[model samples]
Target chain A: MRLIELQRRMAADVMRPLSSRAPGVSTYLTPNTLLTAADRLDIYHRQYWLRLLDALAEDFPALRALLGERAFSNLSKAYLASCPSKSFTLRDLGSKLPSWLKADLGRAGKYGALALELARLEWAHVEAFDAAWIPPLDSAALASGPDLRPTLQPCLRLLELSHPADEIRLAANQGTLRREKLSVGTHPAGKYFIAVHRLDGDVFYRRLEAGEFQLLRRLERGLSLGESLAGRIRGLNDPETAPSKLRTWFEAWTVLGWLGE
Target chain B: MPANKFNGFTDLGIGVGLRIPHYDHIFSQAPAVDWFEIISENFMVDGGRPLAVLDRILEQYRVVQHGVSMYFGSAGRLNREHLRRLKSLVRRTKTPWLTDHLCWGSVDGKYTHDLLPIPYTFEAAKITARKIREARDFLEVPIAVENVSSYAEFKMSQMTEWEFLGEVVERADCGVLLDVNNIYVSSRNHGFDPMAYLSAVDPARVAQFHIAGHSQFEKYTLDTHDHPVIDPVWALYAEAVARCGRTATLLEWDDRIPPFEEVHAEARKAEKYLPEAAAECA
Candidate 1:
């Protein structure tokens, strides 16, 4: 078979349910004297999915631990079936998972928020590892003008969640929380915001106030220092008092190595 | 960066996979490790604890890179980004050679992420060999391809896997990373003769050898790399050493990785097969 045809068959085999995909030309064996073509194709097809699912489980142990083995496995199988990976890299596998959870509320049911949160967290971790490392923004540059690096590391992620997902993740890991009775229909009592960033080679997350989250979002969108503060601090009785807050934020950001001038 | 020194192997002998669990012990205790083999993808990132730790390892040991995602046999155009990152890493580590599996990963453009087997046909061999040559030319160094264990075979293959492997390496003028355990695994999986596979490879091009444990299911064995080298694999390694002379050998134990001592012991077992310690020729 031509390479294109073989690839098409392989893609079909990868995407199709196990029993239906066709076997195409393979490099390891000869055609049809012994083992049937379908039987041979089944081996690669099964393995392709199994290995990825296994990797996802391994990478997201806390999520799996929280969901229980049986539930997590079933969910993973369902996820694989619904969204066959398009990228060559397994690291790109979970990119769609958070949105997938949001869209498939019925399927995710009570676990929808938790699933989204876990996906977000896992993506953050992966991005942190591969994210570009830029030298700290020059103080002179920041003072002089405006231009954020377009190729900045994809690590800094913002998550606006309905539930206190970070606490739940921690609680699940510690076995202090049971997942059996969790519900997805109702939102958590209060709004939850988070800032995920990489610091000193480890991925870290901090809960953010509503105002702080908005301020970071504006900054991320390329607003200049003065403009960002103006946009967020409008209508305040004492505008001069915001300098201390800005100073504290800058200090925290510098320590995290997030500032790039 | 000190002109990226490449002194070749200075009587470094065989090494084992530098897994994360044994990081502290290996660095603090300063075990008798001549060289260390690290997965290229695991350390291909910017500053981190992994690099910091690897810096400590590089201080006392020779390091080489072994990668899994090169996908040299893939019909699609080469992944330049991956190659660029690999080159950057090679410069950083000053590795002698970069290695990956001798199997196609994707067709047009979709990576299975597993080392999927390729057919042993003239066309397949030609394409793979050409890609190897291109990769070597691009990277400006030798690229060694390792054989992978497979669960099934394609019916369209015209030649044995060993013949195809030999043809590719010879035609491409590249090196071979003869993985002994994979030979055993493929033999069991496809009902082939492992010795014949070993004998078929050109000894001159065999740059390295890999030994790892596999899990046994009811019908077939899996290259899970979760345990120590099995007895049969060790025997094969001995044979490979006798035939290929003293090549750089690496023991892989990716899953359920044990302590530093255990990995070192597995690596030390290969020492008996290596040619007697000689002067540092380089």
Candidate 2:
């Protein structure tokens, strides 16, 4: 067989379960013995998912801890089986987890947002650690112009949720939160905004106001300073004088090295 | 060419995988380490703490790049962007050589996020060797491909993995990282003799050695670098060193990482096998 076809078959063999319920596939050996090709292939496929799930759990400890071991394992297994890893590194395994959790099968009303928020927070931490680092845009260069670099570090991620995600995530990580109460239908009211970024070798997140979050989202989408602030400014707002609040926010961002030129 | 002439990083001495848990200890205390081995993917990003910490570590010690995502044996074309970033990282760190796994990670442009094994067929060997040569020529530097631990063997494989490894290295004119723990793990998983695998490797082509730990289940052994190195693996490593002579050896502990001192102590354990490393330190 062609190498690609062989690999696809191998992947399929590894991914399928050992039970009789597994789909019809080619098997060179029976699953009974340790050295059986079926058993060996199963081991690889099992390890493949296990390793990724273990790594993802490690990355999203708060989510795992919040869900309890049994629930976490089941959820992770289902998620992984459904969305087999598409990246070359285990680090990329949980990229879609948060969104997945917020979707129909994943959205267990009460804890759905919390699970997703935690996943997003964890993914952000991984991205911040591994994402390319752009030297913060030079202040002098940005002061002279409004253009932003397209190659700005892709590490910065913004998360908006319908629950107190930051607070709940912190509680989960601290081990003070109880898993029993985090049932599928138990969601709380109120929307939350957060910004996940890396600064000086650390991953950090700060809660954001809805307006502020929108403004940052615009800037992240490559909007110029003037364009991003054009409608957000309040009474007496002008690029030079009236939008003093926006200027302060801009200066704070620049100092934090979040802005790229 | 003589084997000695092909030896790279002979001066690097013994090192351990530079994990994050040891950052503060190595940076603030400046521990007595000969060199540090870094997973290139950890620092492949634009800007972040990992890179910043790596920059600081590079300033203080010798650093070499070992990657997990190069997927050298994949049938798909090599990711040139990935290569460009790696080359840039090499230039920045002045790495003596770059190393990655000898396994295929993706097929038809879809990555599985695991070090998937390749068939030990002559066709597979030829194609893999060609890609390695291309990567080496493109990067303008020698690349070391490490053998990975595998749970399954291809029924179509015509040769043992070690023979395939030896052939690939020789054909590509590249170096072998010779991960000892992987050999032990794969042997246990596949019912092969680890010693035979080591014997088949061309010691002259060996550029580095990796010693790590694995976890065992009732059915098979898993290459999980969570614990200290097992005695049998260390013994195998000693035998490998005896056969390969002195090569840069690194300890890798990824999960449940202990304190830096403990990890360093594990790395230091390799010294007993390397009189050269001992003498250099002495």
Candidate 3:
């Protein structure tokens, strides 16, 4: 066989799901005293699944926690079947998992919303962990320019989630949340606003008010200061309290260095 | 030619992988280390903590970039974007010479992330050698191909693994990172003499040596790198150093990593096998 044909055949055999029948390897591979061609090929096949599964588990710990081990494994197998990694880095292995979960609700079962939210948060966490860092507007600069645009930091991720994903993720990471005791239906769900950002080489999460979330989203879309405040942001319950809340949010954001081009 | 003259690169002495678990110890303790070998892909990021930590590590010690995803044996066009990111990192680390596996792990655009063995055919060698030459020219750095421990071999392979390796390196005008443990593992699996494999390797082309442990299973040995180097592998290292002279050596412990001191101690064991003068100098 040609080199290309051999490689494609080997890759197909190694990438085939474990539950399926093994690929016919005797034609291409040589058997030894201790192992058959099938047995030898199985080594690579098993490593492929084990390595990818372990990587996904590391990246999406919260989603794994929410779905339980068995369900998470089944879901990951399905996801890998559909979206075999395209990038050279294993870091990009989970890049499309959030969208995959959102698109395949039947596979997600009753915990679709909760699972999707957790996956989104985890994926955002991965992005925020290594996204490029742009220098933030310092307090002195902010004080000097009253018309400064509130551009979001490149590393900042604004999430408007229906489920309290941050809380569940923290709980799961700390071992306080158990899949057996939790039910998606009974969990408290509401509009949860969050900012995932990097500070001093560490990733962090900060809850935000609905107005702050909307304003940050607008800023991330490259909105100018005038456009951002000209009724573009909604969900502020009290119009009278808008100016004072905006002042407080800007002060905290400036201190955290969340505003950048 | 001496080992350093293989590609005009220095023997960087003993080193360990720059893994994350030892970050705190590496930063705070600042222990004496000859060098650190970083997985190039781990730091080939846009910006943030990975780069920050890498910059800090660069400040303290000499770092050599080792990669796992070059996939030069694949019969498709090389990924330009991957090479671009790798070159950016090469500028960052300023690694004397970069090393990647001599195996194919991707087809078309999909990646397996595992080093799959290549068929030892003239066609495959010619294609792999061309890709290596292209990468070496583009990156402007010396490149070395590391032999991978593989379970399966192609029935249509035209030659032995070492003969195929010699053919590719000679054709590409590159260096070889002769991994002794891989030799031991593949030799055992494929029923070849480890010494014969080493004898076939050109001493003048050997740029580095990798000593790692493998898991012994009922059927075959797996290059897991989770345990300490066994006696026979160390003996192989002795013979390899004897043939190749003093070369840069690294210990790989990717899974179930122990304390930094323990890993360092394991890497330090290679000093005994090195030439007496070089051992003293290191």
Candidate 4:
């Protein structure tokens, strides 16, 4: 067989489930004194899966907490089987996990939406934590010019999730609030417009109103100040009173340095 | 020690892998060390703390780019985006040379993220050589391939490991980053004389050397770069220095890393084996 075919088969063999015995020694592998051909190959197989599985659990601890250890490992393994790593770095290993969780057969219905949101929230934190850093929009520029199109910081990530996943993350990170036995997959689903940003090398999240989220989203897409406000005005809960709310959100976002240009 | 055969590449003494655990000490204390080698993929992103730290580190240290993800022997196209990012890093760091493992990592667009072994056949050599040459031309820098420790050997491999490595580097006309610890680990696992393995390579083609520690179980040894270099591995490094001269040597400590002084002290251990490094130490 060609080299690629051999590699594909070897990778498949290594990624095989652990329940089975060491896979039949590939006709291609040479047996040595200490290890049979199969035993040797099994090492890589074990290392590859376990390393990635551990990485996943670290990245999405809430998801693990929600699903329990066994279910999470099994689900992550299946997720990995479908979405095996394609990035050069392991940091991108869980890039597809939120979507993978969304597509899971056992989950994705109303009851599973909280779990899916947790996965999305965790991945966003990972992405936002190291995102590009940009200086906040100049306070002087804001006072002087109304035509400014301030850009979002590279580290800034705007997430519209189905649940308040930030609450769980914040609680876990602070170590202040947690249940004795936080039951798996039991949480009320709620909508959120979260602005995940980095400050002084630490990541923080701000909960945004509907109008605020719409305005930030528009600004992120390169919309000018007037245009973003125009879009926001139409989507506001109280359009007539929105001018003050718009000023408040814009000033807060600008002060947070969520823009570059 | 004689100069390496590769032009413009000089003996850079001993260096340590720029690890995350040492970031605070590196930035604040600005520890004195020969040089630092960074895993290229970790800094490939557009913007972040990693880049900021690397930019600052570049100002202080002679940085070299060591990659883990250029699946050179893959049955696929060179990842153009990955190459682009790598070249960008090369320009920023002004690394004299670049290196990655001599193994394929992905298949059919899926990455296994491991330094897998390959067969030692003429066909694999020819194709892999072409890819390496292409990488060199496009990246606009000289490149080399590294030997990885393996638990399994391909029965279909027609030649020994050293012969296969020599074949690939010779055919590709690239340089070699000979990891002495890898040679030692493989020698123990495969039951081969490490000297014979070192003897097979053309010394002139080697542009650098790597010494690291490994985990030894009852049956086999795994190249886990967490421990300090053991006695036998240091001996093998001494032999490699004898043949390859004062090639740029890097010490890697990836896991369970110690403090900056400890890691640097571990890397400095290479100096005892490398004559020029020993003199510099004196």
| Every candidate's chain B TM-score | 0.92, 0.94, 0.96, 0.95
Model 2, span B84-180: residue lDDT tens: 7788788778777778898987776566667888888888788898888887787776788899998766667888889889888888888988899
lDDT per residue for candidate 4 within A169-237, as digits (tens), equals 776556533444333433335668888878766778888887678777887898777666663244465
| Pairwise lDDT winner, candidates 3 and 4 | 3
Q: Give the runs in model 3 whose Cα sits over 4 Å from its true position.
A: A143-150, A180-186, A235-240, B1-8, B277-282
Model 4 misplaced stretches (Cα beyond 4 Å): A21-24, A108-111, A133-136, A139-151, A175-189, A231-244, B1-7, B276-282
Clashing pairs in 3: none
Model 4 docking tier (incorrect/acceptable/medium/high) = medium
Candidate 2 lDDT score at position A157:
75
Task: Name the candidate that leads on lDDT.
Answer: 3
Writing each residue's lDDT as its tens digit, candidate 1 over B54-157 gives: 78888888898988887777767778877787777888888887788988776655567778787677887888888888877777766788999987676667
Every model: iRMSD: 3.8, 3.0, 0.8, 1.3
* Superposition error at B69 for model 2 (Å): 2.5
The segments of candidate 2 whose C-alpha lies over 4 angstroms from its true place after superposition are A17-34, A61-71, A98-156, A178-188, A221-224, A232-244, B1-9, B188-193, B215-219, B226-235, B276-282
Superposed by TM-score, candidate 3 places the C-alpha of residue B231 at a distance from the truth, in angstroms, of 1.1
> Candidate 4 at residue A155, lDDT?
82
